[model samples]
Target: MSTPPPALATPLSGPRFQQTSADLYAQMRRTHGPVAPVLLDADVPAWLVLGYREVQYVVSNPEIFGRDSRRWNAWDRVPPDWPLLPLLAYQPTMMFAEGAEHRRRAAALDEALGAVDQFELGARAQQVADRLVDAFAGRGEADLITEYADGIPLPVVARMIGVPDAETADLVSDVYRTHAAGEGANEAYARVRDKVRRMVESKRRAPGPDVTSRLLAHPAALADEEITEDLLHLMNAGQLPTAYWIGNTLRLMLTDDRFAMTLAGGRRSVGQALNEVLWEDTPTQNFPGRFAVHDLRLGGRQIRQGDLLILGLAAANQDPLVRPVPQASTGNQAYLSFSHGEHRCPYAAQEIAKVIAEAAIEVLLDRLPDVGLAVPAGTLAWRPSPLFRGLAALPVRFTPAW
Candidate 1:
């Protein structure tokens, strides 16, 4: 006999996804096993893969669970302007591409990102950090999320991808809107898409040492639309998670006694804190993930063809079977913060993001050695986002240096 679905589905959004998700995931695991049923924004049903082994199996075995969003069985229930269409709607980009086509685009993206000089990128991040800190240093207090952590990645990424200086701010705004899934998300996605197309045209006219130029000139010989669409994927995917990574790390350093003791000049601990955040508080919590290729059993649940499986990255990291004790995990990079397998975030891109985040955190500490949370740490609010984990605001106080 076939296994039946759970009686009630957990909504992927709202307070359940907020501060208490660890508890929530625990409940789901107890009630529904490794693969728990879930409902997206508009009552669209899917499964949240919560076990470490189960998540790994799903992402690694793409032959069974594919990346093609077009194969989703719930599309008929989705509206054209559904807030999540920007994320779920199929695009020709490598994010939704599968098989040989995915390999083609992934190769170009990997090579292009790999070509970036890590040392130069680190130096560039420091420079960006210095300029940003300069703006808020004399104020004695600032919201680090808006003024610091949220500000670092986009400018560095824009320069990396050859987005013109003048256009970077607007691009940042649109990307934020689309990721936040606000009322204007659809329009924001359209604007960002058009902007990337124009950027590809500009790069073609005069190729530079940027990622876009490299993609255009790569041996893969990607077409304009391919490059343009992937660039949109590249920019949007790179910025938000990275920004949240930085924010979450800073929050850890400020709030936790383990890291707070290092606030003054514990430069070495910055890396430790960053690694811990990945394991405990990964930026991308639940990735809208692979669709089942055929009916099969996964983690004791009966999965159907075209069934969507959300890879629970955070929940998987917390799986008792894999995670080490808290003290032992500071140096452990075994976490699945970056999804695993063929379609995982490229190794090259992960290194670049680390350089950017580490530099942002280190530079802030170097400049404002006494920086501490301006509000009671307990009062800080997390952004009301289901897909990403980040603080809505990170206010801090420091001695004025001017």
Candidate 2:
């Protein structure tokens, strides 16, 4: 009585996510209207929800459009070397779990993250940003992605996780493979997980004032594996997107004369600039997928059970239904940059990422007022992947302050 799963057409994610530009998103919305059929991988079909209302609906009704991918029919047919397995594979953490398990796991994260002092967290961000700028302050040219943006999150997150700075620095190489989709990805994935395992073991042996220690002490009393998975979720969830978000904002601040003038003239705050960037070019363009639970009609499309549904947040943010906001940090949290619904990112309220980004850019520009792109804007190369939207490098030249 039910319709069979849809056949593959073209990948909805993958290289197209690299097309996070406003024009591309507009095209998707215009062509697909709200819901459009696109393959998740080459042969993996899924519906991409581009409407703001539709994304909210799908994410809010997790009971119907669930988080568990193991329930997906395609999971059984896929081979072990599935290139996208690292992303789509089921994990026991809140990221992929359903019902009561999601609550317990999410609680551990919420509590630990809630305990962080915003002032201190912002200070730590400033310190890290300053140090990174110092490394290249003497040179007139620096690749902001490698020297600044790409360098920010891991060490700060490592400290928050109780991972030593040295180890965090070493992870610079491995994190690349973990975020990318291709060869050596599995190996890079192993190294990062093993490192997290070591961190979990270290935290268990000697409790520290970090997220790991806090999770261990929480009422949930997560096991080592659960703690590791949750941390991995945080790493996968936060690391690259946050890094790229910072980079993208900086690019806008440095390149767009109108935006540059406003922020420089004090007409707009750094937070405001960030908010505009979120609305215009959301850091995480797509929210990977939410699989359907049963045969359901949504946005005039027939989606069968276990079919993946990707929410085009970048496109959705600009959806005609979504109006512009007056302030960046105001009560209007409608933007999908932090995602929406019950599964919304806990850090949406933190403002820690904004501080890190603002501080990093301000420090670099303060020392070198003339900083700008080392190459033409069009020449900037981006890492093409469905999971993240980011520049491969942001090469900039500046007047050496030192």
Candidate 3:
């Protein structure tokens, strides 16, 4: 059996270890100087890669770095006899799977998502946004994050995945809160697992054209257990990160007048503006946790087998080595926020950008030209989770065009 690496000592007394998400990122860059290595959570035995190249190297090179969460101490922190462990058990989702398995899952999701019409999705997004805004527009003061940003993406995912409209809101809320706070993680997991199992069983009785049905039809040579795991993976894929990115993007646009104006023009500039927002405010600041499968050398550091590796996506995205070229025709390459490797967030960023951009054009900017934050910029409360950066609420008021 491979031995675990030494535990990380507690962080030094400095502003770097502060709880502020933005500050923690800044300190990582300053102290690590691009490729410098830091440890996370004193007891977690992980190395943080803060440079652009280093992060890319670690993430993309699956042979050296792996996403087998089973190797990490995360589960160990929980009790071995805990029922939650089984529910929280890491499944071989696209994000955790490597090689052929990952490719297969990606292809399935891509095919399903590809079937969606961009224009139609945009229209749907606008309708959702309009209804949300209409509910609160009359109130004058509204929390954009809770009322709009958090509410919009769930139905979009539900519609795509073929969940009934009536159940989408509750499921989405449960999954979002569970994933974000690690609160009710087990309960949320169990709830979704049971739901998917029933859905799959029902589909067996009578299947439809939904994404889940499509996956069930192929099964891709996977077992029933694997199918259940994949379904849970899909549930997570559609919830937490989308909530984070949408909320973060809206916050950015509200804070910067130029960005808001640019997006108001229409979908033509929406993509570029969204890219800027992602670069400026990464949704997932820390790298998705990975475990070293074998002895590996990365950025002049020797990583032995069993070492925990944390690729700092937010830090790498801002690395001066990969300078952001706003005019780059290729979109946002400098930003490693979604990662760039075997376990990268697989078109998630792109999808969210499209939704947010389309909504900004069709809803916010065009319909509420004078809409903006009622409070000053810095007063907005950001979510305090270490994994994702997002606003808790964005209280804003605007003049209705109607």
Candidate 4:
């Protein structure tokens, strides 16, 4: 009546696992066409869905694919005092919930975010961009990732969520690094959890007109703890990848003369450029990890209950079968950069595009005629993280048009 799970195998060691995972993806694309079996972590045993179609299959089918963090073995490796389990326990937000709960929370968020005036937000974004650009206008060279990309998103998020100015900077910084790859990820999570708990308590006492306030006002719809959880999810979701997207888009345009020239001439649509950036180098390379709830077949491989399943977003976006049209063109081929289906990021793609185009790109293009990367293209360093791909720092030099 049901398909049996695939045979589970232990993953390769840490360093080998990372290299092997990357290699396996390349090999799968070459051989299997779009989807292939790969491993998740060195110590944890899990199957990675490295093709676009397979990822879509898993993401869209929650009955087969579950997003509960409890399914992950990485939990065992976390320190006993780590805040991850408590955070998950206290707030099973949409990301960690399944079925109806996930859908309900997602709907609420969509309504709240959608109700806001995007055009007004765009005007606010322009002001934020102008201030940031002015801060480094005269400097011939600066780390765009640190000075510009990272700084722009914080104020916007704070305004969106009603975080006070004094606490915004530290809170944004802690949350950004919480899920980052490396040994310090756990510690970062702890800091983020503490900050979030404090912020939630503060919001509960004095709710304002921000997203958090709106959630609190609808207490009958969601519990306080659930509200906190969703806030944390929004904070993490809104900050890190958006920062990476901004950095990556700037880097891509700076290094590629054609892209830069096109943007400069105003011929290239900002929306198209944003879409191209998402497809070319997705900020989140891997899918939000999911688990097989029952015996199931995906990409011709059988998976059983409790088995960990990872959907590869980066691999999926490049699927030949999916055949995503160039960002400049209009078509219906699926792209997995922000993912698809129930658990996918709703505002992630649009939010990134809006901020970068209306805020960052518009400011930069007007002020700098030939903004480009200062370091050699080959020398740029990508932060080593499987879940997200971005530059550690992007150094650039430009002459201000003014």
Candidate 5:
């Protein structure tokens, strides 16, 4: 087993990570070089890859840095109640699978997501956006994070996976709780998995034209347990980031004068804002990641076999070596927000997220032409979690319309 992280390693969690993570990354780079030694909850040590090239290397060479969490050497030190257990625990899903098994699961998922009708999905997103806006349109004031951003993506995703409309409201709440990483996070994760399991069972009895149903009928012959676990991953992966993408992009458009001028029916600026968020404030800031298969050197650090390396995605995006001028990211798609390599988010899934996020913003701007932040921008608080970056609340006000 690999040795524990050095005494001087930085703990990955705390209030310092909530808002100013870029600064934290800069400090780590200054202190520990590209691959900095870091600690997770309970002082479990790991490497945080803060360099753009280093992160790219880790993900690209999956043979050397595997995705299997079962290879972790710190499991001996981790207690049963660890908060990140739900994220790191090995499961029968593609996220943990390697070799032939990974390919099989990824192929099935790609086919399923690829078959989704983008035009139809966009219309559904618009419909969902309209319904959500209608709820607060008359009030003239609402917390966009809670009322709109959080409400848009999951319902569309749940329905796409054949989850019934009646059950979606509760599923949304459970999903948010799971990502909150606070009290009841583990319990919320369990409930979300249970719901996905039930959905898989229902799909067995009566299949539909949805992603889950497609996976069920795929020639890959994935077992029900596999499908259930993967669907859980898919739902969590697809919904949370997309919701935050919408929220972050909206926040940028509302606060930044560069984007504020374009709020009046400017599609180009909306797209620019979406891309900018992926660079500056990605939804998934860091990910519990690739395990070192054996002793090797990365970014000048001596990695031992079974060592854990957390992908510092946000840090990599902000790496001065690659992004010397942040403004140059206006139209660049080179950001690592969707990750890289064999285990990166599926292209179709990325496209689906883009469709949903774009529709959500365009429809909102259409409905509330003068939407603006109701509270001072400085008063806005981000949720306290290192693994994810999102606003706790985005209070906003606009002219009421019936």
Candidate 6:
């Protein structure tokens, strides 16, 4: 039998952290076992949990590893300029709450999302997809990521929350950049937050059959400030990764001959295609800004109180300890794509994400059977944000409808 490896000594964000490579997973497991210390952009020390069981342990035991940033190291050593700050910094939403507070806020949010009719949501998704395809079908070639993938979610989400599509369409165009490193990240975040807050206010005054109005009506009776924060989180959740899931899944269908054949044969449902991506290339990759509540030893490593802990959903999905059959799609909660625990994404949100992605993608494939990548798959560049795994662009050519 082989020996277990020694835990890595220094916090290192080695090259593996940058790319989606099998080599990265191998290195993470070999160098540090399941859990390892790694540096965030500015050499900020944090634990990167890469094992399937190990990640489940951290997320499930929130009392030990809390989500509140106030509990983060008292040193205040991590600066605002830290590149990962945009993604890691705590916010006053269900994603950052702990204990009873988490349950309370998550329920309020779920109720708000539940007000959305699934059939309408799916129909709207297809409508958005149809509009997008009409915009470029006559051109014969277009960038699917920007022109299509990124385009579907914003309008659909806007309609769900009572926000007019015309008002949010241009603003949300920059939503993905909120978590990206470098210029305008903070400004982009602020802009989208302000815009969503306005929608909440609009809902308060006029109240409609949309999510924002439902949140105002929920018994949780959240203050406007809390509501704003929650809606901002929702905007982030509803837009960014869902957009990428559509793109990544489309990439699979267009480039992977296996998926292409599956689509052509009509033997597999589009929902199954989406589940396969959620298993293999989950778009909502790494997330949750969990912090250790006290000095403790976990996964063969000593974690200090306040030490930042991030769940490596992407890595965990590919963890060797777990056998994930990507081909098997039903009820694969085993993958931490949407995360798990008290802070898991709401079931309503989950339903919308799946239906929207599946509907939008199915619309495109049915309309443009001959669509294909303009550039080679390897030539595509993934956005560098550590939070969401997304492509920079997916240039594709389709037989012109004109």
Measured by lDDT, the strongest candidate is 5
Residue by residue across 189-289, what tens digits does model 1's lDDT show?
A: 99999988999999999999999999999999999999999989888878899999999999999999988887899697999899999988899999988
* Arranged by lDDT, best first: 5, 1, 6, 2, 4, 3
Q: What is the Å distance of residue 81 in model 2 from its true position?
A: 2.6
TM-score of 2: 0.91
lDDT score at residue 39, model 1, on the 0-100 scale:
81
lDDT of 6 by residue, 167-270 (tens): 77766755766766657777777788788788788778899888888888889889787888887788778888899999988888878876777664332657
lDDT of 2 by residue, 1-402 (tens): 223345434364444456444566667667767887766554556677889899989999989999887767666556666567777788766888787888888877888888877677667777888888888888888998988888887777778778888888767667777667677777777788889989999899999988889989998879999999888877766567778888888787777775667543432456666677787777777776788899899998888887788878877877776654423333345688888876778763336566667666666666667777888887776787765678888898877867
Q: What are the RMSD figures for all models against the true structure? A: 2.0, 3.0, 3.8, 4.2, 1.2, 4.1
For candidate 1, the 10 contiguous residues with the lowest summed lDDT are: 1-10
**Selected candidate, larger TM-score, 2 vs 4:** 2
Winner by TM-score between candidate 6 and candidate 1: 1
Model 4 earns a TM-score of 0.85
**Runs in model 4 lying further than 4 Å from the true structure:** 1-24, 31-37, 40-42, 72-91, 265-267, 324-333, 347-353, 356-358, 400-402
For model 5, residues 1-402, the per-residue Cα lDDT tens digits are: 559678689987777877788899999998888999998888888999999999999999989999999999889878777778778888878999998889999999999999999999999999999999999899999989889999999899988989999988988888877776667878998998998999899999999999999999999999999999998998888888999999999999999999999887768788889999999989989998899998999988999889999999999998989888876865789999999999999999999999999999999999999999998998888887768888989999899999
lDDT of 4 by residue, 1-402 (tens): 222222443232344334344454566667544444443343434566777767878887887777886665444544454433333333467778888888788777776676565666677667777887788888767788888777777677667767776877777667655655445555776676666677767888998777777776663477767777777777787777777887877777777665767756533555555666777677877754787777777676666666666677876766656654444322222467778888888764356445545466666677766677888887877666557777889998887533
* Estimated TM-score for each candidate: 0.97, 0.91, 0.84, 0.85, 0.98, 0.92
lDDT of candidates 1 onward, in order: 0.89, 0.75, 0.64, 0.66, 0.90, 0.77
Q: Candidate order by TM-score, highest to lowest?
A: 5, 1, 6, 2, 4, 3
The pairs that clash in candidate 4 are 6-302, 52-316
Off by over 4 Å in 1: 1-6
- Please give the RMSD of candidate 3 to the true structure: 3.8
- lDDT by residue (133-222, candidate 3, tens digit) is 788776667787888778777677666666778877778767765555445666766687777676667766776766666666664654
